[model samples]
Target: MDLIDRVNEISKRIKTLGTTLQTEEATKNALIMPFIQALGYDVFNPIEVIPEFTTDHGVKKGEKVDYAVTKDNEIIMLFECKKFGAELSPGHASQLYRYFSVSEARFGVLTNGATYMFFTDLDKPNQMDAKPFFTLDMQKFEKQEIDELKKFTKPSFNLDEILNTASDLKYTNEVKKILNAEVENPSDDLVRFFTAKIYSGRLTQPVLEQFRLIVKRAHKQFITDKINERLETALAHPELSVKDNASPSVLLNEVSVELDNGVVTTEEEIEAYNIVKAILRTKAGASRIVMRDTKSYCGVLLDDNNRKPLCRFHFNAKQKYLGLMTDKVETRVPIESIDDIFEHADKLVETLNEYG
Candidate 1:
């Protein structure tokens, strides 16, 4: 199986057995060990994967990390494990951090069976960064996250190649976190910046409060407008709708219906497809969900069957709509952004269950 399948397998185990795992050792045997094996490492091989690997820090003896992964007779990665369902924090990585400085490992992982946090010496050489360069949650992950995890596999492990992208991934993750927070609740500085640009009056408590709400609404509308612009562009140029090396099962079909007619599949539509797939992933495999674009809307089907219509993206117009089927009747619900599809997750799942 590929990385996605392997990762999904682990996800299934977590969902099914997570509650039963009561101890740290049980968590390791049930979830963490299989994850190591998924990365093409032999957990039983002491040479490749050392259990309870010990490293000594200055004036500290026998400081042990959960596991140490070696390649070519050299330590390549370190791991620290916590019990199932435990909330992982930077404090949990102390032993891993100490091991990183002493060992030749370039990567350190802290996991609680479900969430894996990958740390590297991006901030300083031989010292693990306080923040993780990449984080993977077994229960919740995207295709791009699986792609990133694939690079760490035994076959594809390249120190320089991963380091090249680690900096960008680390900073990008941080920036996105900050941006998400700002979008949800505009910071004082962010509100003031927008206020200066648009408001002519003096900055007062009342004005600041007023601008805070305005900034929030403006951000939402701005995002919606940008999505509409992309949809318009894709509709104008149907040829550009086809992505290079696109996954047929995940995103676009091998020969999309768009090619038969003038219908164009926008990137936003592809994003919506992925979102729907993620929502119904546990109920239905991603391969079962297929994108079949039409001139009016982009239809997502189960098992490539029109009778099994899951949802549709009606993005050809100014106001986007998510076409959901219930009792064989289509409901075109108006949505501002692709993220809004998550709101009707139960309805989407219900539609899929009807077919089953």
Candidate 2:
């Protein structure tokens, strides 16, 4: 299987098992071991992946780490595992921090089975940072995230690849944090400087207050407008057109119809159905996905996409959809079938329209 398939499988397993491994040992057995296996290491082989791994020097004797990965007798990576639901805070891995200082390991991983955070030193050699350089949440894995994660996989593991980008990720994150703070609370000096420029050297309490409100409102509006523009771009695909007065016969002939029952009836439905079935088949947990139709509306119900319940289908501003869950739904895509799902002509269109 490819990385996407592997990630989808892992996501299903993680969801089925849930993130609640009762004990630290169980977490090591269930979460950490599988992660090592994913990296192509034999968990049972001490030469590749060793448990209770020892180091040459550390804070105290008998201080064993959860796992250590070795290559040519040199420890290449260190991992510290916590109970599944345990928070992966700095305090959780103080022992790993001490062991890192004396080990030959260049990379350290802290995971709670559900969340993995990869860490490395930037300020000093062999000193691990409290914050992770790359993080992956097992619950909602994305394509880009999986791509970055492939770097740590044993076959492609390269220290230079990780180190070369660590500084940029760290500094970029730091800059974003600082900018976010400024956006929330503008500094007095910054406010005064801007006030001087705008008011021509006049500073007043009422004026400052007014300027603060203005700045806040401007910032909020800018973000809102940018978000709407992006959403429009994402949703404006030609393939995502709504057909006026589309009947069931037209839909069956032109588009695909996948039913809630596990059966593919029409030639178009069979083609499109195969695509969606293939997606949910690998991950049984994704079986919450269902399809149905009525006189007015025909659509699919996605229980959760990326760990959130997506909203119902509403095509042509006439077909009203009522969801099983009455909670306020957000982030929904409306379409007749997979063929008309995207904003542009895609493989979905090619595959489904072929039946017509």
Query: For each candidate, what is the lDDT?
Result: 0.85, 0.62
Residue runs of model 1 more than 4 Å from their true location after superposition: 228-356
TM-score, model 2 to reference: 0.58
Best by TM-score: 1
TM-score of each model, paired residue for residue: 0.66, 0.58
Give the alpha carbon lDDT tens digit for every residue of 15-45 in model 2: 7775466898987776678777887677888
By how many angstroms RMSD does model 2 differ from the true structure?
15.0
Clashing pairs in 2: 237-343
Q: Which candidate number has the best lDDT?
A: 1
- Give the per-residue lDDT digits (tens) of candidate 1, residues 137-187: 898776667868978888778888899999999998899799879989999
